[model samples]
Target chain A: MASACWGLPDAFCQFPAMDGKSLLLMRRTIDGTFRDIVRSWSGAIDAATAPLQIALNALERAFTSTPWIVVLALVLAIVWAGSRSWRIVAGTAVAMLAIGWFGLWRDTMVTLAMVSVCTAMAVVIGLPIGIAAARSDRMQRVINPVLDVMQTLPSFVYLIPVVVIFGIGKVPGMIAVVIYAVPPMIRLTNLGIRLVDAQVLEAAEAFGSSGRQKLWNVQLPLALPALMTGVNQTIMMALSMVVVASMVGVGGLGKNVLQAINNQFFTLGFLNGFALVAIAIIFDRTSQAFGQRLQQYRGAAHD
Target chain B: MTDQSVPTLEDEDEVATRPGLEIRGLYKIFGPSPSRWIGAVKAGMTKTDLNRRHGHVLGLTDISLSIPPGRITVIMGLSGSGKSTLIRHINGLIAPTAGEILFDGTDVCRMSAAELRGFRRSRTAMVFQKFALLPHRTVLENTRYGLDIRGVPRAEAERAARRWIARVGLGGYENSYPSQLSGGMQQRVGLARALATDAEILLMDEAFSALDPLIRLDMQRILLELQEELHRTIVFITHDLDEALRLGDRIAILRDGRLEQVGTGQDIVLRPANDYIAAFVHEVNRARVIRLSAVATPLAETEEAPRLALPDRLVLEEAAREMLAAGAERALVVGPRRRPLGIVRIGDLLAGMVRPSGRPPTDQAPTGPRGKP
Candidate 1:
């Protein structure tokens, strides 16, 4: 293959490429090493992930077993509380009713549970990393390229490693979703903190605020809008990853969509796809409105 | 221009008892390796030469000034003259390349990180030109920021903050966020915040420079009013000469990161240290700054006492107003306890008020009249 590509010239056009045999050998070594590591760590990993499995199961069960009307009321209440807008609440109600009418409510509920858990986990993990990156240039330099790779790499590629470690369950699906969705949360948080007014930070320092005080009292509060945006993006990315995650034996609306695609059931694919979109819009709007509400002080009348 | 009489603390025994800041031979070179160029900067290198020859910017060079306790010491300079840098050094916000900031006989430059924080929290508070209040916090919360950082109980902090808020005339605006207030009101909050800390040293870096002329005057009045009772050892930084003259008990003028002159406002206005400072003070309204005692005529052997007597501390403008109101041709310039120190006529006051041309007044006592001290 190398010779074929270099056929035009002996020097300039001949790229310094590793031959196919070496490439294949390198791939086998990496694959074998990863396999050995996963096999050795599988039991410990399962034990570590047990709590995650239990929480995800409980959330899914709660969503699915609860009466549909109660779930609708809960969601509507959350939307209203976040937005304080009657219009958004009405829109959410109509969307939830439409999903129920299509008989995809149970699947939608499962996806919601998975997305909520994934977003919570991402925020819990991403915020500190983001803050560390904001505080130190060295940390940011180390994390930036890794986050780039996490965001740009194909979602299915990482799912392979996750499944190899977790053995194809909701936990593996969740790990994959979090890995795919956490970059925005981390990046936005770092950017937000870095962009806080230097004058304000200097004032914080001038007031003799301890490191923890400065972070909690100034950086975190000021960075709340960007943090909220990160959460919103994490949720949307997690939702988008659901169908791909379903390929690894995870069940939800994503599984239904995957089945529809495999069986070439166009109506089923459209139905599940629209259900996902409706969920995305509702989550996006509510979270964005909540973020804006948090920053209402910014819009107060300026003298 | 040759006479540079920097005030010494040895003479002021009363002021020495209170904690005052003494900056000794401070040099700050801003670059990756500031220490590398400090020797050159201290020896003779100019700010431009340092920045041009080496990659380092000379922030401050060989600045040594004594801030008397219970008085306002204004560090006045144009932008990039290191006035702001000098102020930050007082609180150890920016460490010096070399030299010591002596506060209560302790070297602030040598303090550990925790020690510096403790010093800043307990001994000093700062007001910024741009009013760096937390947008998320209300006026009361912002005012209590320093106390909060020191872990003061919320109720106690709020009580102190409320008193200062009302003191700075932001009484009714405690609950309003910073964005909701005007620049003047926001700076009042900044002042209140610093004041609430009750720190002996108030570091105000151009605190009123951002306000409109009227509001700046208003803030200055409030500060002066407060200082009458508070007597904080304030180190205010300002580019405005008039503001410096009005507020500073002792003013230190900076030019290109070096001290041009350190004296009372009358000293600078009457006898500038160099041509640079002469040019700086040339635009100042002499009547407003120069006092009657600086230009008063001594009481001669055969001279009779004047009918009208005015306090020697009165500025030329105020004396002129007083003399003109009484229609007196001359007045005795009396010192403390009503001792007749000198006499000054309307002609002398008029001559003193007029701006000098081309050359600065010589180091000799101001030329118009010699007071019998």
Candidate 2:
């Protein structure tokens, strides 16, 4: 089959006689563009390195060689502030300190920053698109199939497109993180808008509301709780992407875990993964709790 | 036929001040078929018989009635009787199949889109059975929503809404969302919204039916108060005859997409034009419905009559109350200008305890002694 395709092109070249020169020119242009693309990738990498180094320095200053007692105390303060359970807080503090005693805090902080940045970008881009999709049937028709493909395609498949578009850097990793995390917000927004009561819509119409007025006054406010749930899901998904994204040069606890796997350091890899899970749990709980609060306020206000 | 049965206006004030709304030969037909086939089928059947055979599902048909200004005309019917469909036609929510709806002598069916919209915003307003209050808005906001659509400034519209809300007896519920209010309260919000527009005609379709019984009574009283104060021409649709009787100055009874009769509440109850109408009034308490006119016999001359004075048009019960109060054996029935018409005695009341039929006097024995009116 390969030989057959090559023969067809070669036959065309023979027939045209000028096809050879055109093909040569096409190849040259392709090569020039590829070089330009490579140079641009290198420049972006150089620019991105400063931020990465600065982040690493911050992590290093915050966690590296810090006394286990102080780190434990900070952990206790966080756990106490969040859960408010003294025994659980004490246990968490001891556990975090033990991980730091094993020298894993710097790696955990790097993982935290990568997940935070990825989650933030995903929310900023995904939310407006989700809102647009909710309001428009045409937008939904265009977006739904794209979201289906994004969700069902293998996790590793996202890396190929991101690598081609962004080249090997933290930005490519960020792209992969965004792709993996965006579908939930879109789906949730669609569901929320669809779930608004028909009687409520009729009431708005009876009030002489214009289309825009109805959407802003009734639809968006009612959908806020569901949108918050989508945000929470997006954050969890971004956090889940952290480990896989590190393969494209997103250095973090994910990188440490990968190195530990390579070096047969079982305890170090397990600890880094544990820290990732903890951060994911914390974000997930906080967002879900906030969504519930929003629901309560909306219900009381509506009544 | 000319309405020879309608008595001349006793007082000039009793005549309609304005020709409120006039509808002419309204027709609404659904489904698409060649007219040749429909005409062929319809040719063989009278409309009522056709409706009976088909189960009468197409809402309004050939409805023509006028609502006089400052009068409450109740359109009474069971479910699927086209009352709601008829009201919807006035605001152009549902266009008539073929009709001329004249709003203060202007044809509504001929209005341009912009004109129709302005007409709806300014000339006519409606309250629905479901209250149809915008759920997200406060009572005040919902009340002002129509005014807002009409381009009234925010503060002015809201100020107007506040007054109307109080007028509808929804006084302190200004900032509360619909979900926070009871069904009756929500309906009051709807009433306020419609009234705030200052539309001359108010169309209420089963407006109080959704409320609890006690609340329904309360709302009905409030509605009567509003009607009294404003004297707006109101077209109230309800299945409940009691509600119709309590509120309507004139009542139009509809059955199976047609108007059976249009008359005063007393006229319908005491003098139904047909058997279907008779059945509607069958359960009504005759004592409640009978006025002095129903049993009154015109007084005789030649110095042989008892001296008592009564108007011929009052209900029999009301006449009886007067007879008992005045301790008279017979009451004199007077014509419009207080001319001596006849007499109504307690014996005449006893003799009238039989069914009223439109057939000649030969069908039953004489009620006491009949005399000319």
Per-prediction TM-score, please? 0.91, 0.65
**What C-alpha lDDT does candidate 2 achieve relative to the native structure?**
0.72
Per-residue C-alpha lDDT of model 2 across residues B186-228, encoded as one tens digit per residue: 8989899989988878888898988888999898888877774
Residues A82-179 of candidate 2 have per-residue lDDT tens digits of 55556666556555665566676666666666776767777778877887887789999999999999999988987875676566766678778888
TM-score of chain A of each: 0.94, 0.69
Enumerate clash totals for all models, in the order shown. Answer: 0, 14
| Whole-model lDDT per candidate | 0.89, 0.72
Q: Whole-model lDDT, candidate 1?
A: 0.89
Interface RMSD over true interface Cα atoms for each candidate? 0.8, 3.8
Best by DockQ: 1
Query: What TM-score does structure 2 among the candidates reach?
Result: 0.65
